[model samples]
Target: MTITEPVPTGPATTLPGALSLRAEKQPDETAYVYLRDGEEPDGSLTYRQLEADARSRAAALAAAGLGGGSAVLLYPSGLEFVRALLGCMYARVAGAPVQVPRRATGLARLRRIAEDAGTTTVLTTAEVKHDLEERFGDHPDLAGLTLVDTGALPRAEWTGGFPEPEDIALLQYTSGSTGDPKGVMVTHANFLANVAETEELWPVGPDGVVVSWLPLFHDMGMLFGVLMPLSSGMPAYLMAPDAFVRSPGRWLAAIDRFRGTHAAAPSFAYELCVKAQEEGKVAPGLDLSSWRVAANGAEPVRWRAIRSFAETFAAAGFRPEASCPGYGLAENTLKATGSRLGEEPPVLWVDSVALRADRVELSAPGEGAQPLVGSGVPVLDSVVRIVEPASRTVLAEREVGEIWVSGPCVAAGYHGRPQESEETFRATIAGQEEAGRFLRTGDLGFVHDGELFVTGRLKDVIIRQGRNFYPQDIELSAETSAPGLHPNAAAAFSVDDGERERLVVVVEADGRALRTTPLDELEARIRTAVHEGQRLDVDEVVVVRRGFLPRTTSGKVQRRACRARYLNGELKAAAAAERSAR
Candidate 1:
């Protein structure tokens, strides 16, 4: 079935309106339950309280002379951030929710975003803002921003209400894991349509207990953890993402503790869940029968990860049918496709050799087969087409091509980037004049038997632990790690070493460093700088001699060539790194 715009939900077209209706209809009903560090609830709020808090925050923004514009939201994951988002909806402002950066490079990115969005006002918690200012006061990137604590406002002063359906509600910045981050304009209509369609796949009601530990800044986290509950009239239980990282069992234990019915997470989380079970860290009394929809999306869903999770947790009342693998990007408003509830997640085993030739060949039970989990069909309100990238010709089922999508849930365009918006959001078909709008997702996938199987990205993006890391960014970080490196002679890439994505950085070690510094020490320095700047680990740092990396005629580093060389065991390092070729 082709996707369609949402059928009207009785004045609940916009998020704020839906929330207001819920509060009026069930004022005393619990809307959200938040946990900070333990199993016990840190705080809870009812629909009435949520509405009041949102309105009060909006009123505060209005009093501060901020309206009809966008405001950057800077807060950690918690109820305060949720209210800030809701308050933006009521204030008729688009909230560009950003995480509080902890590093200088991250600060620069936040600065770039603020400058791009042209915002001077920032919404944050009083405590968080005060602490941030104290820590980041000297940094010019944050010095000019006027921080407003929306949570501190009184409910009586709330004046802003529901916004227009077509008004811009949020600017979900693309995850920059593949490239530079750009804001995707998500209108109220887009928000409503996506929420309605997502709920159809993972059906839920007021009694549906939703548990989440995703960071609110990520689109996947924001869409599922913060907005989905309000739109579907479900109660959500939230814990900070860091808490889950420290203890994956906390996330699973939360479901068992709360009898959670629906939950969404990235592939890493499912892997972590499996790791927890293997380590015997999972709660013994955990019962997952109530968790019917354990949806995994945001990153490339691995069949092995889902299969391990389902197999390990089957004894705990978890059903294989509950493992839902899906696909989505920020440009499509979070979820473009997902498995239907009660259906075992779709998977395919393709011959590794044929796949390289852009052909799909089903593999035998035991061979050099690549396992790919199907992201399921396009949402009811969305149209997904596998298209030949160069020709724009729609491909037949099982023919691998770029994934293109169109629907009401599709974003308007990239914010302030008209050319990119037109190219990515309003793509043209090869010959179908009647096709009005389609988004060219830079993802390679195929449709077989009405199921979409994403293979890999068309861009040189390294997706690790569900976060996209651009190769250029990593290369720059590595190049500038020390002055000994040759200019534009570093490459960064990711290769899956069976278990997970391994990041490899190849650099040209300068003659001075080769003579003066220990090679391993230099590699360690590069690792520390990259980790400090990008907030992630590098699997290997290859310090090669001059002219080691492949370069094009324009002196541009051929990252693919470098990746090929490394993968083929042809890359040589000048440093004495006992690195084994993966």
Candidate 2:
């Protein structure tokens, strides 16, 4: 680990981004370390070597007549996936790294996304060659499309190269919730802003090692795991998501083995590790003192999850101050706001009754109701405002409204969708005529003590008898109060009952643990908790088997998918679905 002095304050180059410059400037430093498959020796690349590979591949694609504007999709995460994406950057091509669907793997999604991007080239590994051949080998739309597999072809050689900071580096796929995923155009300017912002807020030196198992398809995973480390000339320890899922203890072990200093994950991961500890599944005695930045993001942060995990791992030398809460979306590149390293978790308690009735009220803990975790102030060069969702009135701090972001890090817009882009990015704010044009986040939150506290998405909120309710509030209550409920294994949604919406919570029950506790009593207690904790009338409490809740490859709960299945009559209670056949 070598320390590269920071570039002095001056006019910054917005194009071709930081990664390309770091590759050229620190070519000999280790850029990445891929944990070899099947227990082989780990594979690594220096900054120079990785850049050379990217340049060679870009030149190769150009020689093959696939250059600018050509779209290529990588298979989730790996050294190959990242190198190919960088190659796209080097060639000035728009790259889309997609999540390979487990049900129907192939160029099915690729062909559609490429067609949208006007792309004729696709990059992938040999493992999915047969699927691609079977799915789109004969499709008329894929005619003349070039499919390059690095697994089969020898590595292309390069002479030398670099890209400008203004070039389009990657086309990030967004809307993992509903409709066909749309591409978010990210330029070198966009990429550099995210890197600088993250570095400024949570500075990591060249001596740092980033250990990640996040799927690289998503922007956060790709930026944090690959680009962030590479730009800083730090080494990254990578592993397959399956390995982490099978044994989360391996993640902690990997950190201990590599003496990793920085890591990031969603709240569910923290909950999962806590469960592993409670079940005696994870081995004890792993040292986590080397960790400095433990970022919790990609979804809403649950304070309980953080507290529980910190308590369980405190004896292992994990510091609570290292825990960082952040907020970001694909539209703002990868990062937006994060608590600085070695800072206490920030929380804002508010009047529970006022929060539900009026939507904006902040107070001290015990004086009010629930204590919510704050998302922290915006990073340097970014400005966040809570404004009226309809009129765009910039409200004072502590006034709850739609969260809006305006800054250099804010992305240009959604790719290929002018209508959606106009609606999301073109909103006018009260104040300066040209400045404070906030990006409507569709998220409801308030600013308290100069810190942002996100409650829930505006679209995801349930309205009942003129009072507002967030699903997370009810879900968290059930997890805390239910006896047999699996940790962090519950979802709350709303169903219309003609006049108003009704609350429905589905808890993933631990079947083995349920035998000792009465099901009737457990259900009653959960219902009571929800009613008392959140003041919502429970319509139904469906307890299903563990591992039944569907999640994205990146470990985010597919709430829309769950709601779709629930409405389509596919999801059912474990006992009822079993008894029906008998």
Candidate 3:
């Protein structure tokens, strides 16, 4: 149950060193392949070519006097992002991979990140730079910044040495689902340690091929799509996020074509693939037997999604045991715990009534039971403790509390926020003062039967009449309540109505469904389902067109943002129904 042994450290300590070693060992071997539109091969790089390109980028950065400072990496998902990231590693410049700004809000976020990192340089492709300049050339926050197109850099040789293990390698910005984004300073050692831990859990042989359509800005994408394969000396197949979004089947087709052994995405993506297959959108006769690890993370792991996907893809030689559920955060790099390879992920059914009281109890298969999927056990030298948030007391097994982790993978702290970092990253457990600082995860989970079972985020829990409720549970009920509701597009939150807290549910519905089904009937179905399922009366139900509800970049419903929009009358509700419930 206790997997605390350290993973073997490789001869290379830093990312640049790892790539250099791989280049020397396998110069002609393909290191990465870019799949344009998730199907056609557009470009590729051998180990030798990749290293040379990275070194040239490093040389350009050094010549620009940008060494030892941070630069925002604003490239789209492709080979350019990978080269720029590795180039920063070689130059000892902290690379902050940020999503390409498409709107005012995204641009504001980019400006905040740039200000926080104390940098005025932006590294991106020439096309993107030209477009940004044409669109937002006179924007106040962007006017003073210098955008350097990496593709246009003059050829030069890198003479700088590799960065030290403790040097900052990346500034992984947290997904601002609930609040402002903060940059987590990930050191070179942190990346190496996380890769080592992942390799120990899911060993990738020389034949391993990683296929990913996840955005490089996200931690899950950077680790699995770039770092893991690079460190394991395996080739990775990359694709843009839009390709998978437009056609979920492309992801599976890529796996089939490339014989990909490892791939990962959020749970909704799995659900989408299932829907696509059911709709006859996926290509027929896919041989997915080669996929060894179908990692599901970056969001809550849904047992329904796992079971549905395994059952749907069973005809394609997809093994049920290949589904790996994991738990992690930006603060801990990528993964803290992962399901063992070649084993079925564990699921536990707990009494719903007891769960509301923060107690775990076995329950039969009925309306009163709620399923909790196991996210596996800790890997490497990582130590996980379930500590009561307010009391700072360590809880026994099966007792739900905030998850605190300490390991080499944990980042140093948030960039330029000393006070907040001290509170979050330097917390001491009660009566275990000398056990080293633990990173407060703000997640609620417990170690039951030697496996971690995450409950919900501490801040997202809704309290109604002194009873605890998780927004995900409420959102799930709303999703299945009616056929018109969009999958994974419900936001449940409580709002104060001059007295106590009242439940409010906001959901997105397809245009066809909206036209066919009566609005009153749809609202009634959602309210009745929640009332019967959770024994909680909904005070208001607002239904909007599809894509109205706000979502984070990783596709998680931003409940707080939805609540704000609802309060400010920004959400144009297609139909709304309210009840005076007390």
CA lDDT of every candidate: 0.79, 0.73, 0.88
Best by lDDT: 3
lDDT of 1: 0.79
lDDT by residue for model 3 (1-582), tens: 111222224588899888888887888999899999999999999989988889999999999999999999999988988899999998989988888888767788788888889898999999889988988988886877889999889988887678889999999998754347799999989999999988887889867999999988889999999998998999999999999989999999999999999999988899899999998999999999999999999456999999999999999999999999999999999899999998999999999878877888978777799898999889879989999999999999999899999999999999999999999998999988999999999999889878999999898889877788988888888998987675689999888889888889988888776878877788899999998889889998888888877777676778888889988887643344222110
Error of 1 at 147 (Å): 1.8
> What is the per-residue lDDT of model 1 for residues 213-255, given as tens digits with 9 covering 90 to 100?
8888878788888788887788889988778877989988899
Alpha-carbon error at 429 in model 2, in Å? 0.7
Candidate 2 on 1-582: residue-level lDDT in tens?
Answer: 121234323434532235546655676877787775312336777777775677677767777666667676757457787777777776677888766644432345655677767777678877665566676667764576677785454456543244556666788876455336677777777787888889887888756999888888877788888878866668888877777777777778778888888888888788878888888888778898898888888456778877888899999999999888899888888777788777877876678878876456667767347778877668778888888887778888777788888887777777788998888976777656587465777878888778788888888777777887877888888887855665557788887769776677877777664665566677788899888887777888776677777665466656676777677766664547743533
Q: Best candidate, TM-score-wise?
A: 3
After superposition, candidate 1 runs with Cα above 4 Å error: 1-11, 154-156, 177-179, 461-582
User: What lDDT is obtained when candidate 2 is compared to the true structure?
Assistant: 0.73
The CA lDDT at 434 in model 3 is 94
User: Predictions ranked by TM-score, top down?
Assistant: 3, 2, 1
Candidate 3: C-alpha lDDT: 0.88
Clashes of each: 6, 8, 0
**What range of 10 consecutive residues in model 3 has the weakest lDDT sum?**
573-582
